[model samples]
Structure formats: C-alpha cells, structure tokens
Target chain A: MDPSRLTIAQASAAIAQGSLAPLSLVDSYLERIASLDGELHSYVLVLAEEARERARALAAEPSRGPLHGIPLSLKDIYWTRGRRTTAGSRLCLDFVPAEDAETWRRLEAAGAILLGKNETHEFAIGGPDFTLPFPPARNPWNTAHYPAGSSSGSAVAVAAGLTAGALGSDTGGSIRGPAAFNGIAGLKPTYGRVSRRGVFPLSYTLDHCGPLTRTVEDCALLLQAIAGHDPLDPASADRPVPDYRKALERRLDGMAIGVIRHFHEADAVAGFGPENAPNPAYCAAFEEACRTLEKAGARLVDLRLSPLLDYADANRLIMLAEAFALHETDFQERPQGFGRYAFARIGLGAFFSAADYVEALRARRELCREFREATEGVDAVVSANATAPAPKIDTVPLWGVFERASYTAPYNLLGAPALSLPIGFEDGLPLAFQIAGKPFAESSVFKVGYAFEQATPFHRERPPIAASLPGRT
Target chain B: MAEPIPPDRFTVLVERAGLKLTPEEFEELREGSRFVERMKESVRRSGPREARLRGVTRPREKTAEPAHIFIAGKD
Candidate 1:
C-alpha cells in the first residue's frame, strides 16, 4: 500500500494492527515530498532525517495514541525549538526558538512525528509575495494559479499528500481560504480553543491555531491532540475538549443548518460585476450541498445577520490595528526588513487611530452578538468559503484582500468554529463551503461537515498534478 | 464617504508612527489609505439599525462593552 495516500485514521489503524510500520509510513511521505515539493514549494524546510529518526524510535516502542508516528507538518509561524522557524520572512531567516510552541509540544507528546515546516504568508497577514524569504506555495491543482494564503503551504502539503495533516494559523480566513482553494479540510476552531503560546502573533484576539488535513476526520484527530487550556496563553480557553471523533459518527438527523445566502449571492456580488460574482459552479454546488444536507434529515433554514462587508471591515480594522501594535518597533527600526506585501499590508495599521481601534472592537462585540442571535435557531451555519476557484498567481492584486468581502472572516469576527471542506470542482480547481457553529461548539460543526463529507465524493478527489507523480499511479 | 487624509496630515501620522518610507512607498501607502478610510467609516457608523435604515440613527448604549475584557491576575 502507498502509505502517503492513507488518511491519519487509516494509517493509525494500520499501525495499531501491526500492519504498517511507522518508519515505512514516514519514509513514504519523505519520498513524496522530495519528489513533488520541488515544484509545489509547500515546505520551507523538510525534516527528513529527524522524521525518520522519530519514526524508527516509534517503530520500536508501543504506540502512544491515534497520532502516534503520524507525520505532520506545521505552518512556519509555529515555533520549533532549535529549528529555523521562518514565518516566511527574511527578518526571521536566522531566528530559532528556544522552546517549541505549545501546540508543537502537545503534538510531540502525543507521538506525532514532525515532517517539517510549511510556508506561510509573512507574519500570517501578508499576501503571497515572491519577495519574501520563501517562495509562496503553489496550488497543486494548477501551479500557475495562486493558493490562497497565509496558510498556503499547509493546505498545499495536505492536498498533495505530502503530509497527512498540518497545523495552520487563521487570523482572517488564512486557514479556510487556502483550504477552500486546495480542496482539503481546514478547521479554525473557536478562538482560544487551541493555545497560541509560542506561536507568532498576528492579531492577538483573532489569531487561531488549527489543523489542515485531507479529510475532516483527520482534522478532528489533529485537533483532539493539541486542544485544551494552556496557562501560559492568556487567551487560551479553559474548557474540556469533547470526543470530536465520536461526534463525527452521529448523523445530521434533525439538525437545523442556517444557510447564509446573501453573503455570497448579494452582498459579495453587489459592486463587483457578473465576472466577479461567485462562480456558477460554486453557486450550484452550494445549492446541491444544501439539498444533500436536507436529504440527510437536516433542516435548512434561511438566515441573515449583518452584511458581509460589515464583518470584513471590523475584522480588517481590528487585525491591522493589533498587528501594527505588535510590529511597531520593527516598522520603526528597520522598515526595509519586511517584504513589500508585509510592509504595505501591516503599515495600513498606522492609519487607524486609537479611537478607530476601540470602535472596531465595539463593533465586533455587536457583530458577535448579532451572529449569536441569528444562529440561535440553528445547530450550525453553512456558507461559501471562497467565492471562486483559485485565480492566476500573477493576476492577484496587491490590495485584493481588501477589494472583496470574505465569507470566512465573519466566523473569525464571531470567534466561532468553522470548517472548510470541498463541495465541488470547477474548471479542474476546487470549490468549497464552510460549516460554522457557535463559540466552543466545534463538535456540532464537525458533525455537519463529516456527514456532508461522507455523503459526497469531493473530499476523495486528488489533484491531477499529484496523481501524475512518478510513483503515484 | 470620508475624505482622504491630506498629504501633510498623512505625513504627520507616518512620522508619529515612526515609519520612514521611501517616497514611492509613501505614495503607495497614501493611496492605500482609502481602504482604511472606508473601514473606519463602516465601523464608526451606527449599529445594525443604521445598516437596515440608512437615514435612521441611534445612540450607542454607554454600557455596551468591547469584545475584550480585562481579567485581573489570570496570568
């Protein structure tokens, strides 16, 4: 069997049954990365030797758990002790952390082997720019197209089967955007659900550390290991993590899912012409997904809150203000140390006055309350993740992030759990939708996502580029 | 719509923020400020009622709290 293609659940089960050796599984992935990553640019660093060493050790010992010996990569924003953890910027090229990020520490204790570090947008807020220390990861579906970022490489790696799973940070659609573009599963757990201790900060209140995987079940497995309270992280939630895997087995019977249609159909398409509206394929797929959910005994309820632009505005203003506060010293000391995208994007923070920051915060509270009330009648909400498939890499505008309202940003503003999974394909690229739930209601979100995933074949499809690899066929 | 920040005022904000940008960079950022201005206007506008009723306005409650709250000695 080709171990690289196996999901985390399948691989762990094989290992538990003594049918697969951890060393063999790690070797399979290392070989795939060595062959495919040269073109994909998914990994900034590949810990081949370290991964093999851990796999060998695990092969000789008793299995630790479901993730024991599973190879996973982390977005570079995560701190890895003694390893070069460049947040895809020249400024951090030589910087190494003395201690591992809390997430990394937890995953290590759970028997996960580190495959390497995936690339990220600079500081996790910038757009994909070639001038950064590392080349931005390319979409495996079509390398000429962009892989929406800042968790660009994490999603690319998972979708390409270079890594079974990866941990990515989401401040404003960073995780979900790339996941939507790359045809994978990404979960932005409720804010503070996963500890950010030792992870590089973007927007302190908005930053969420979560998993990107090929399947929703793999996302659950990865989240189970790193979730829970961390005393060191001031924002960490001190709540018990439920059995996310167990929750997935429950069908969507009697579940009421809110469909926020205006987010994509009206508000997002308002100013932009027909060419800029959500792809016809995406709209059709969204309707099909709603039908599928209904057939599974879920009740689809139309819901509306504030306009998508309102959430986008608040999320952006707050993120820029907080990010600027964190990097003010650097901007002042060595303004040229940053990439053009990072400098330009983060510099916008300077324009926001202290009053603007506070006002944005107040608006965020109201928006969150509005979302809670709107979603109160539903078990979860479903909406578009990316309005369209991946665009041409060179065609992306520098300020494109601000040019459109984001469907994923609404959940970020509300601090709710959101899962992005493939819903369909268009022009050989992926189209995805998000299932979001109330704060700390990750299990319900996962239940809806898992049910839809099991009912569809989208998640099982792989990129043609990956399938064309020398050993893949 | 909010007016753009005047060049002199923009310069003052940049200097106050301690950012030293090349002329070209400064020009680009100055142009980019329109997006920020738009966001500022969106947030400064009155709450949900104003969104639904464009001409209607209401005073924000004094007791409405920001999303973040201070917890003493948690660390």
Candidate 2:
C-alpha cells in the first residue's frame, strides 16, 4: 500500500503487522518526491539510491522502533554525512559533514528511512527568499503562498505529503511558523529536550530540535526516539525519557489552557489585525478553531503578553548576535557567499555589544520565568500559529523581518515547549494554533494536543496538491 | 546585577561579535536593542540568586509496573 500520509507511528505498526511492506512504502515516497518536488522545491537534495539501500536493509530486519521503515525528511540545517546542507544559501552549498548530527544517529537507530534533505531559510534565520540560489519552497496548499521558515521545506514536505514527517529545529518559530502555514503539526520541545550537537546553530542558547508531523502521536513517537541525554550536546537534557507515545493515550480531563490573546487582536504576521491584515477570512477561521478546541476538552483562559513586535525585536537581536558569532569569520572573509537575508540579519549581529548579547540572554531568562509562572496552573497555552495565512511568495519583502513580531518568538524567549497543530482553513489557506507548556513539559502539551486532534477532523483533510502525486492518497 | 548593554557600545560589540553589516544594519540593531534592553531588565531581576537557570532536564525514569504502561489498542 502507498505510504504518503501515514504518520510514522501508524506505518511502523502496519509494517510490524505485515499490513504494509517497508520497501513498497519507501518507493511510494520516492515516486511522490520525484513527481511533486519539481514544483514544490521542498528538498535540497534527493537521496534516492542511499534511501533505497537503507530501506532494503530495513525490509530485512524486524521493525526496530516506532519510526521503523518510515520515510522522514531532514532539514538542510541539520548536518548529515555525505549530504550537502546548503541552509538555503550558496555559502554552504557544497559543505558536507563527516559525522551525523546526534539526532540523525538517533533517528537511524530508530530505523526511519531517509527521504532526503529539506530546504531551509539561510542559516535558519532569513527565509523563503526567491533571491537565493534555490527557489524558496512554497506552501503546498497554495503554491503561490508562503511556507514560513527556516523549517520551510520540512513543513511543506510534511504538508504536501512528500514524506511521512520531518525533523526541524526551532530557535524562534522556525519549526512552528512553517507548520502553521503548511497545515502540519510541529513541536518545539523544551529548550534542551533534544540534542543540538549536529544541527547548525542559529543561536546556541536558544536553538531547539523537534519534529514536524501530520499528527501529535507522530511527534510523540519521533520525540521518543530522538530525545535523551547526549554527552556531545552541552545543552542536552539528562532527564529520563518518559513514555511520550504512551502519554498520548492518557486523558486530558482536567488540563487548563491559557489563551495568549494579544497577538490575535492587534498583531498580524505582516503588522495589522484581522481588519487591517491581508487575510481577514483566515483570521475568522483561526477563532472558530480555538472555539472548537475549547469545546473538545481544553479549558481556554484569556492571557496576554507584550506586543509580539517587542518579542520579535528582542528575538531578532539575539539571533543576530549569536548567528553572527557563529559566522563572524566567514562573513568577514567571504561576504558575497551569503544569501541576502542571511547577510542582512546575521550581519546585524555585528552591531551587538557583549553587553547587548548578555542583556538579551538575561532578558530571555526573565521572559522564560514570566511565561513559566503564567503556566503554573495551566497544562498548556493556546494562540494563533500564524498572524494570518501565508503571504504570496514573490511579494514578500526583504526587510519584512522588521515589520512585525511573530507569535512563535515568545516561547523562544521563555525556553518553553510550543507545538503548532492544524486547526481550520478558509479561502484555500490553512490556520493553526499553538499549545504551549511549561519548561521541559512536552508530554503534557502533546497529551492536550493529541486529545484535541483525536476529537477533530482537521488532520484528516489533505491538501489538493497531494492529489497530483502518484498513489499518494 | 549585570548592567544592560549600553546603546553606545553597540558598534564595538557588533564588530567584536564579527558581523559584517552595512550602515543600515547598524541602525536597525540600534533600534532593535531598545526592546532588547527592556527584556534584559526582566532576566536580571529574576527572583533569587540560586534560581539556577542552567540545569539539564530529562524524562522520568520508567518503573517495573507492567500492563498499565500499555493500554490495549490505545497504543
């Protein structure tokens, strides 16, 4: 049977039960990628032979874990041996890592088949830019719309049914932003839950690695396999790995959810509210989805944070400071090699002082505390996954970074777990909502999310783009 | 308590941090730092000296309890 939309956990169970052949499953994805990628441009490279070879080996072995024999995409920012990680910029177009990122080693051990490397915003900061060497990956639902970034390709690939799911890193909404507009589920786990040893750093202190999937259980399964203590990653959490997959089976009978309401009323992705925002219909859809989620099982409390613009400003500053630190020498030595957005944003890091960087870190810690206290009695928090629907691809401006704050960055400041899940759609555009939990409390967030998803039909709806693929549906 | 990074030191900090910005990038950073400074105040004023901001977190250890961990069909 074809494996286009199966969550990793679902397919793993099917393969283990002889319901789906692993080799055949891999072939379905390979064919889908070949046929659809020409238009979506979601992948940085297509590793057909390598993936097939691995798939053949997995076919012989008993499925090892939840993601066994499942096809999964890796973001370009992730370092993989023998694969080019361009980070959506020409500067790293040919660079390959000799060692797998720690997460890669874990995913392989879990037995997930490699689909290929997905595209990203340059260096996981600036993104969806057409000016880069490769065309920015477009949202699969509406090819003309934006697919948020720097988890751009991973989100689109999962949304468009190019692969079962993908691995993405989020520093400031890179994972959740793309997931929202692409109509997939993304989990930005607690700051240190997943190791960042091999993932390229945008901001060392703020960077987090997690999964983008079609469902919450899939995210739980992926997180189970990849999350644990890693000696190589200084920031890796050393806690015992809870049975995250099992947690999904638990009830959400008494969980409290707070609503981060400020962004929806006044903030827009491009700087205006529903009335002034480019897509009013999309905003209405987002509200209706929240109402439905509230009715399903979650208790929605009205909560407010500072303007997203303030959080966005601080986040951009910290990202610049740290990313510039990572690329300082390369930038000074070969400025021409970088994409325009990377050049502008990372280059801005040059303007930050040691005091400024430290100030940002201190502020980040404070915000994390404030957000944590706000979540004391609540199981998770809810908010718009995006201010509006994805903007038209070619029309996005270079300086659009400064225009507004993002809903995704507040959690980044607080080092909390923020997950984005599909809620509803209108005007051919998808709207999403975030379920955020306290620091290192991803399982609770997943439980709340999985319960809501189990009660709703949003994840059941596939984009029209998947119909163009062979045997996908 | 750590004093927030002053606005005037931004140029040297950016240069030291090793970014290559045009004149405009510098101005954006200057403007952006206004908000960053406010956030820094929040972190600097955290409750206690030993609040410990940097501890590694992990999942709870699994126990020997058997069938409760796995629900029928729910898995």
Instruction: Compare the candidates by lDDT and give the number of the best one.
Output: 1
Model 1 residue A342 CA deviation (Å) reads 0.3
What is the alpha-carbon RMSD of candidate 2 to the true structure? 8.8
For candidate 2, give the lDDT of residue A61: 93
In model 1, which residue pairs have backbone atoms overlapping below 3 Å?
none
Residue B53 deviation, candidate 2, in Å?
28
Expressed as tens digits, the lDDT of each residue in A167-245 for candidate 1 is: 9999999999999999999999999899999999999999999999988899999999999999889888899999999
Off by over 4 Å in 2: A249-251, A266-283, A468-473, B1-75
User: How would you encode candidate 2's per-residue C-alpha lDDT over A1-473 as one tens digit per residue?
Assistant: 45666777778888899888878788888888888889999998888988889888888997687778888889998888877777777888778889888898899888987889998888887776667888889888889888888898999898888888899999888899898888889999987789999888898877999999999998998888888889778777789888887778434667677887657666543232233353566567667766766676667787755455545555766777788778878887888787767776666566556765655555554555557666777877887766567889887766555454477887886778989988778677778889888877888888878887887788877889876454345
Task: Evaluate model 1: give its lDDT.
Answer: 0.89
Report how closely model 1 matches the true complex, as a DockQ value.
0.69
What lDDT is reached at residue A361 by model 1? 88
lDDT of candidate 1 over B1-75, digit per residue (tens)? 345677998999899888889999898888788888988877765566435335344555767788888888775
Candidate 1 wrongly placed segments (more than 4 Å)? A271-276, A468-473, B1-4, B53-57
Q: For candidate 1, what is the TM-score? A: 0.97
